[model samples]
Target: MSAESPPGLDLARLRSRLDADRPGLVTGPLSARLIEGGRSNLTYVVDDGARTWVVRRPPLGHVLPTAHDMVREHTVISALGSTAVPVPPTVLLCTDDAVLGAPFYVMDFVEGTPYRRRDQLDALGADRTRRIAEAMIDTLARLHAVDHTEVGLTDFGRPEGYLERQLRRWGKQLDASRSRDIPGIDTLRERLSARLPNSPAPTIVHGDYRLDNLLVDDTDRVTAVLDWEMSTLGDPLTDIALLVAYTEGEALGDEISSVATAPGFPPVRDLVARYTATSGRDTSAMGWYLGFAFFKLAVILEGIHFRHTQGKTVGEGFDRIGASVAPLVARGNATLEED
Candidate 1:
């Protein structure tokens, strides 16, 4: 492969990489534009001579270790390609730091919009909203149904202590991002750890399953599931619980007040019912998992809040994340106690 002078991640490098690996790869001059709104990673749309591609990489500035594993992200998506799940086709992976100043992966740029705001949800008609919601649940069910052994991911994560490790991991993250002691975080953490639910069998879990992390086509079908940084082998119910926490209940009502009052959005019970019917897993344990997901998200948001306070993140959403911490903790406690 002939190495050209590293261009400023413009058409030159994009074309060069594609040409080197996929000799007949047709593309257009790379016109790059940033896809704004994600708190964790930086995403860009790069159009080559004829086709558009997406490049995902870690955010700028200091990053935590193993936080953004591009290789793992690429691997999981590539593995899912043969499955019933819908995911963007991963085209190339660039591990060399010299290319983009960080490890990154390129995927077939999907032509769809990600719902980032409640307004976007409102604009989508009730029928489309319901279809998209059902699609999300179905996609997640298919994901959890994938056989890890067949996907060459039997060793994807240590499932022996999945819940325990998750509690510890986020607990450590909370400590690292501690700005001030929240009233109930410590107590919630203790209760969550003590009440860790039993696992049936380890299944692939999308750590951050939510409406915003997905892309929907004109038909309201989910075209791709984005942001696999926190995906791992664990109780798949955790994924369902996260979906519930972020979408179904009053928690989401608090996050997006307008949506809570909307007519189309399905309730938490209906979502759980759909998941139970599709996945056929005993969801009686869902309460514990829901609590855990809320606690985990609270810590992650708190981490962002910490970064924002340190001037690491420059924006409005992050600065307000701390406000959700207490509510999230309370929501978690409620889930644990829900009969």
Candidate 2:
């Protein structure tokens, strides 16, 4: 790629800053390509002659405070470099807004495909798909087993009442973003609050742990676990639950008639078993955690629906997402009852 600046970025200023940061560092003609998939952040693939890098910044227009803390994201990824987890190498973090009009971080871009749907998995073959899934689970188990204090993440999150704060925080977010009151949203929130599960010792939890967030190589190994924006110290079960929620009815155990054919992924029980074996943690309360995960994702999707109703969301899918919230809440309630 040439040293020319890519569209939507300030080339001259960025070049100047780069020159100042590392004298004689070669940055050839820069071409910016917007990467799709995420709705909350603006991600670009920038190539400068000899090397390619990824830039992550907040989306344009109004945004919530501390919503996209690039510094925090950069810090976490940088810290993970020494861990067993696979993470992209962070090159630079620019808190100075003058460069990109917002805080941004550049990291070495990893090459792999994100598994977003069943077709993608099928394309990779059943054996490869299963291997990738297992690798993902193992990677998450390793992350949760890491000692936060040893890795300089002890101060990353406030563990005291973390679950309570999350419940309140997301509840407030839903209230602020709701365009219309869907049936059962209030009841769901109330039930989630009342049935808060027993809190375990805090560990690093990836708030979103779905197939789409992972990059799998041809050999079915996880090249990288992307999107650490929602990562923090919290109940490790929270991470496991989110993984279960993403696979619920879609991949885990028996397929639900309401949903389509199973994605052929391992059952949640087996996943928990693997994690327990790897991390030496008890699996007794996994059901409650899975319920919590579904409930949280439902609230978040509802927020997207609210944005869609206000004509804020682009493209299709948002219209029907609001309808899934109730089912997710019911799933959560059912899990709690089972416990």
Minimal lDDT window, size 10, model 2: 253-262
Which candidate comes out best when scored by TM-score?
Answer: 1
State the displacement of the C-alpha of residue 336, model 2, in Å, after optimal TM-score superposition: 2.7
Model 2 ranges with Cα > 4 A deviation:
1-12, 249-264, 308-323
Candidate 1 TM-score versus the reference: 0.89
Candidate 1 stretches greater than 4 Å from native: 1-28, 248-261, 314-316
Give the range where candidate 1 is weakest over 10 consecutive residues by summed lDDT. 1-10
Per residue, candidate 1 scores C-alpha lDDT tens digits across 29-116 of: 4567666576777777776557877888876664655677888889888888888878899999988887677888889988777765
Candidate 2, residue 130: the lDDT equals 66
